[model samples]
Target: MSKITVLVVDDHPLLREGLIKILSLDDDLEVVGEAGDGETGIKLVHECRPQVVLMDINLPKINGIQACKVIKEQYPETQVIVLTVYEEEKLVLDIVRAGANGYLLKDVEPNTLVQAIKDAVCGKAPLHPKIAGKVLHQFGQMAKALDMNNGPLLTNREQEIVRLMAKGATNRSIAKELFISEKTVKNHITNIFKKLEVGDRTEAVIKAMEKKII
Candidate 1:
């Protein structure tokens, strides 16, 4: 099996070293490169083209949010996980807006970070538990009078899947809850996004609320 290639980016030398060490313990993960600043991180991303990037919020040059945006725009397939200590709601929102695949704290357990990388590569948005609540809260505040004049309607199953999605449930969790396979859950979410005309889980939630579909 091919191991997941990762790039560690942070200003702190000790932290970057620690993260690389943790990644080394995982048989399925490989650290392809490391950087001490966001500019170098971005350059390394171009050079190494790792599968996932562990980005820190406070970088010397570009900063995590902007770097993440650059990566997503330039290489959407390369997942970026913001590994930061800042958990402020606004920072979470900013990182999410910049298209981070996951938001995890520096204090996260090594095993959890490893699992988060795997989950992220699998297309799951693995937010820290606290950050998850902020995203959910943002969705909660998004209800509006929907102009459904051209909006497509979702089937009952799609509604169920999306509702779970709004609750920040993973594909695995949604499948287990609905007694379906993960592939089936993914299919449902794909259909939901298509019907809702949204790009991601966050947009789907907001669109669902706008239509009062959930």
Candidate 2:
């Protein structure tokens, strides 16, 4: 496979420089460019056409979430991994909704950061363990908040699915535990998304919790 091209975006010069240095040690990866702000990052991304972008959430001109949305919209093939200090569920959820493929806390080990970059390049939703709980709780809260009228009016079976989803169960596991087919699970998810007005599982769970439907 070709080397993965990466772009670093952060307002802090030291952080960007450190990341570049860390990534430089990886022979399989290449740092294509760097930017000091979100807008500049977006422009560099378009110009550099990097396969992956290590983006910081706090930036000068535009916020990282907005930058992620712009980059993802214009370059669907480019994957973004948020490298931030924020561990709040709301922030993580917002970033994911904006199209980030992965999230890593700022204090992550060098090796882990390298692994996360590789994972993001390979289409995996890599998340720091410390932040994973927050993400999962966000999903649970979403499942708990749903009410019948506004959220997806889940059937008893679908409700079961939502419950497992809130607990962070994958579709295959849900299928195995519930004795249902994966296709059936997917169909339910589609209906769930339509009913809840959500595009992804995390959002669906959040909406469900908001309405107390699940």
Candidate 3:
């Protein structure tokens, strides 16, 4: 059988080297390329066309989430498994939306990580247990909130954002109204999405209004 082609993308030189070293010990796995940033990772993806990509979230130029999105868009068959230290709920959802095949933490055991990469090539998600818990719990909360017709219990600031959203206000407009940065507005909206279990601003607004939370 041909070795499973892989690419390692991370901002830290040490981490990238370390992952390469681990993969090197596996006879069936091949490290085709390594990149220190997401931009280089994307470039190398095209050049190497690896079967699996081990991606990190923090990087200069383009972030791993955006890079994963681009890569999956262009090469839907390519498997990108996010390997990061972040356990943030929103980051998990973001990467999931970007079409990551798996989510593994930095502290994963070497054997487990290796097996995860192998699983990715076979079209399976070998999500870290903690990561899987968070993803499932999030959806569970959303489902329960929806079933109970109670909504996700938005914060005061999040309610303000949703009310503005009902008026079709843009993120910039909401930020200006709240005197917070645009990124803050976006984050608040993300929370709103989680609470309400809605996908976009329109859906969020409708849910909030129907529940009389706005």
TM-score of 2: 0.73
Best lDDT among the predictions, by candidate number:
1
lDDT of 1: 0.85
Q: Write the per-residue lDDT of candidate 1 for residues 1-214, one digit (tens) a residue.
A: 9999999999999988888999999999999999998899999999999999999998998999999989888888898999888988888878877878789987898889999999888767778888788766765565444454546788888888888876658899899999999999988888887887866776687678767777
Q: Cα lDDT of all candidates, in order?
A: 0.85, 0.84, 0.83
Worst 10-residue lDDT window for candidate 1 reads: 142-151
> Over the stretch 89-192, how does candidate 3's per-residue lDDT look in tens digits?
99998888777878899999999999988877764567888987887676656555564446557788888888776554667777899899999998887888
TM-score of 1: 0.80
In terms of lDDT, model 3 sits at 0.83
Could you estimate the TM-score for every candidate? Answer: 0.80, 0.73, 0.68
The 10 consecutive residues of candidate 3 with the worst lDDT sum are 142-151
Best by TM-score: 1
Candidate 1 vs candidate 2: the lDDT winner is 1
Number of clashes recorded per candidate = 0, 15, 1
Candidate 3: list runs displaced more than 4 Å.
145-214
Candidate 1, 99: how far from true, in Å?
Answer: 1.2
List all candidate RMSDs to the true structure.
3.3, 4.2, 14.3
Show model 2 residue runs off by greater than 4 Å: 148-214
